[model samples]
Target: MDFSHWLLLFCTLLAFYNLGIIWFGQIVVYPLFAKVGAEEYITYHTFYSSQIPLPVILPGFAHFLLPIALIFYRPEPVSLGLALANAACGLLSLVVTVALEIPRHNRLEKGGKQEDVIRELIRYNWPRTFSIMGSAFLTLMMLMQAFSPTI
Candidate 1:
């Protein structure tokens, strides 16, 4: 119930939540992009973008930062290494989101749902999705390690 503990709980919760989203996105959401009508695509994409920031961005950014904080404050080498891995994954996800996915979404908004673009988005998203799951695994490992008895 210290700061590091709080941060760990928050990061762990968020990481799992993001893992759920990642699966849903890869399996359901992104695939449906092609089905939206060209005229309505922008509106749909706009609404999606508008709504996702809170659930997605807030936790994601927090998760990214939490690991670094843990590294400094907790300083348990095993958990710290896991935290670093989580942070690295989180950072890569953010970079991919901003650099690749968002622009693709924007293009889809303007140009209307191109199959190629949609396919590209889906293709490009695999790394970020896997990264989030990896982060979740690391977060879980860190939490378990923190709670377990030390030999």
Candidate 2:
């Protein structure tokens, strides 16, 4: 019914959506990169990187920003501690994506058939994935805490 409530709901939904994407990307998508033949891998990677679905891209960006927003806005159900933890996870995810994964992806785009990069991508993705999943859990907990009848 208010700005804080909306912020909490948006953050919760985005984090949950991101967690799903992370799990699917980790388990299904990233592993399959190795299967693509060397000749086609670069083309596929280029297309994949270029053509990220809007639904994925927008919310993905929001997931990165929403926690920071939550930290400043602090809804009734959302404690400062929870917001800080969520922000930490969001920041970690952003760092991992920009610093680690993006470079590795860039390398793969140029260095075709780099199995090492692919391996590294998969290996390094777990932290980002876990952080997203953790954010989702934290958001859900905040919601429960918000909605639960007061003692």
Best by TM-score: 2
Candidate 2 lDDT tens digits, 57-86: 678778987889888776676688988898
Distance from true position, residue 35, model 1, in Å? 1.1
Evaluate all candidate structures by whole-model CA lDDT and list the values in order: 0.81, 0.87
Question: How does residue 33 of candidate 1 score in lDDT?
Answer: 88
Backbone clashes in model 1 = 0
Give candidate 1's TM-score.
Answer: 0.90
Q: Residue by residue across 15-132, what tens digits does model 1's lDDT show?
A: 8988988889889999988888887988888888788888876876776566666667652534556767878888888888889888998898788768899999999999999988
Q: What does each candidate score in C-alpha RMSD?
A: 1.8, 1.3
Assess the local accuracy of residue 95 in candidate 2 as a C-alpha lDDT between 0 and 100: 92
